[model samples]
Target: MVWGLRLFPRAGGVDELALDRALSAVDGPVRAAFALQLLEGLDESGVRELLAEAAVADPVGAMRRAARLGRPDRAGAQAMLRSGEFDPCTVQTRPSDLLRRRHRVRAAAVAAALCVVAGGLAVAVEQGARGGGEERSPAGVFAPVLDPAELMRTAAERWADTSRVDFTAWPARGGRTDDDGLLGRALRAWAEPSESVRVSTTPGTASVPPAEPPQLLFADEVDGAAVVLFHDSADRVVRYAEPLSGAGGAAIDFARTDDADVTTGAAVVVSRTADGARFLLAPWIAESTTRDLLAPDTPGRPLEVGPDGVTAEVPRPGAGGACETWPVLQLRSSERIVEKHAFLLTDLGELAPTHLTYMPKPGRGTPARQPREATGPDALVAWARTACSLRTLAGSGVRSVNNWAFAEQKLPEGGASADWVCTRADTWRGPGRVLVQFLAPAASPADPATVIADRDDTALCSKFGQHVLAGTHWRADSGRWYVLGAGSRAVTGIRATGEVRGAAGGPTLAVRAPRDADVELTASLREGGTLTAVH
Candidate 1:
């Protein structure tokens, strides 16, 4: 007989139900001893004190007897442990109510162990008094009658019609979920948050509740605090947690989602502990890995996925500031699309991962798709080192970013080619801006290149607009100076006036001039237009 359940309709009934039935058949002291230690997660001292108040003869003997009766198959036991059954919040009887029925049981004794205040509401169980209440009863009264399987099934059925991935498909993990008190509060806060519950939302995120019951995504202890993540709908991801310092009330944070988030998934910075920041990866992701952006060719390290998709701890971004190209996480979806995400420690304690978008070259048409891994090391390394790529443009509503080498000038003494590159960032809501930098070769791979002549928002770097860039830098090796100017590839020729007099054909111009020359440079575009350089 499979799992010894031939007596019931199903053979596989040797689960928490079977265990509960076995415990109920035992004496009251035995049942109380088992539930107090196993379900409440109380120490021997706490269990003994509560059992003593209930007038049990020997707490240790009762506990030993209870363990023997309650033991189930190994698999059943693990499932039972993960399920968080018979928690005080789920059961109908409060410790106060149970104490009232016992002659020797005191409210103080039970409250010290079972009663808890969460979100300004009591989490203790409360049930109606039984008839002939003075008589002793088995502690099976505290056992939960409802099974969690039905709830999971109901949630799945509710999400069946949605096009997005069902939230029920993801296993719930994280937080001190085994802690009945904390898990109960988290569940309650999501299902029926009261006026006293605190709520927060990121810009453009929705604060409304879902049409149906929200789905549980994560529940675990993080950074010494109880944290929970729930999906209100395909469009909203909500997080509820206790204050990290234990000084303030619990709060709910909201983040808006779109098709981009669904296809690429995300890895959120859930907590920052002594070890470093912890990440919670989206459940739909097939795999997650990270590589140092500064070292583009280095092998990427695979991050181990924990229960419910949480990742192993990672080092927080160093103190080098935005100049430092922090490591990037690459999340590969089931569809085989790999996305790159950048994370930064922000004042908004819990950090959300920022999605990186790639801008196509000017004539390449609209961005064909969302950003993915760069095609080559040069592109990846260039983006990784650009100050405008990750940090400065993260929250600026950026939809895409591109780094274009507008001009390549050979060093004054035939040293090497130095590139004048402009980074164009386009926002989702329409406006775009540009940052220009000059990159000179450096000695080591660790020091990829140095950026100079950095300028921002001074020139047009869009396909629909045309402009030119000109700047002068002194060369110590050549003992002379030169004026450099460049326009888009469409430029046919360039002319210089004012203190510097010279003319050069084609898209780039380099002419020997005095260091302080006030040069007025103009460019003729192949598309029939003359544009002046912005200093």
Candidate 2:
């Protein structure tokens, strides 16, 4: 005689099938309450009063429904009610027969209260009903609440403890059971106490900067290994990094653990493959308990590659032993190409390393590419002459080159690492002066030359600069130039006066140019790579 089922004497007359069907039709909470009342041997009045407290409307009708369906065994009902471990408040709600009749409103309030009191049991029942019991958590148990600091500290200790033990004789590969057995044995060995391993805990308020509030720092700097854990306010190990160290003069390999979990944290282990190339070992932790606490293991998944390079899924433990997935970026490189490092771009735009190993296949043997020649002030001046030819300045009667000045400046794109050459040229037409200035990459030749130019009516004392009225600015890339300033006047024509040459100390065009003439210039780099112009 199971709970919720009626027990019958072995006389074949009872229609147990029909009775079971009727009992199954009742709501879980209602059925549970009814079972409890039957088991408790409540009288008619007591039953009715219990129903009202449970917010079950029409107590008589509910009982009649159950009776018409089947006779539930008192002992079985009592066992079922006890197995569920319902809270006292849930089993006995507020005493009010009047409220039971108006169950629509009262039941709603009672259901809310039951949800709070019953904890996971109520949730399991509701989910079980909806999902045919497939979605229910374990009966009579609530989700685990984790302490982040304790979890990290425990993890750090486990890591330190395991590294010192020697597992050199373990079999490398075997069947599933054998593999699991080997891993378990190895982990046990690692967990053994060792004199070489050391553990230290620091208060959150110590001089060390805190990563977040309510944190605890743990460091396991063993003889041959080191680990640092930063437990955040939520008690989750938010950050874990391996410190660089020297052992036997070998380069130190660093690894990072994924989000901390009770059972095991994902770690990227750096080790060399048999072929002498570096490879990363990302081991999935097996499910185990520590000090009677459950540490669930995470399932292994295929590693993914994205634009940011290799990505490993790190499990972030949430409240109640649940975990969220966080993808961490890793570095990638080819034997022929330079290794490129990647950083974890956090929400605040800060970059941190995922600290995983990457080994790309070696490329075919080929000669290394030569670096480009450095573009200097002379190269920029030469570019300017070709850009500002007499034909390009035709209408203004600009016959000769003028004063030139060059300076090294910073460009917008490359920051301080790359240099830009700023060149300025001064020309004049009698009472008017025209100034041309341009910025070009100083480390490499601008594929196509560009210039920023302005004109001023010297007679009116106007200064020709970047902000001149209708000043023209153009960008040249790959031997083509186009106006960048929309309102500026276009170059009407351009023709090269001579071979492009750098101007060191040249005659001022302002002293040699004709008066009352406006310059109209057009310029373009020709197909042969020479600067051509028409004016």
Best by TM-score: 1
Instruction: Write candidate 1's Cα lDDT for 180-252 as tens digits.
Output: 4554555455545677778755445656645554555677767667787665554566777786577877877
- Model 1 per-residue lDDT at 389: 34
Candidate 2 lDDT over residue span 324-370, tens digit each? 22222222222122233221110101111112111111123432222
Residue 190, model 1: lDDT of: 52
The 0-to-1 C-alpha lDDT of every candidate, in the order given, reads 0.55, 0.28
RMSD of each: 23.7, 31.9
**Model 1 segments beyond 4 Å from truth?**
1-215, 231-236, 243-252, 262-264, 273-275, 319-325, 335-350, 357-372, 387-389, 394-412, 425-433, 446-476, 514-521, 532-535
Instruction: Report residue 490 deviation for candidate 2 (angstroms).
Output: 25
Backbone steric clashes in candidate 2, count = 24
| Per-model TM values vs. the true structure | 0.54, 0.16
Candidate 2 Cα outliers beyond 4 Å, as residue runs = 1-225, 231-481, 486-535
lDDT of 2: 0.28
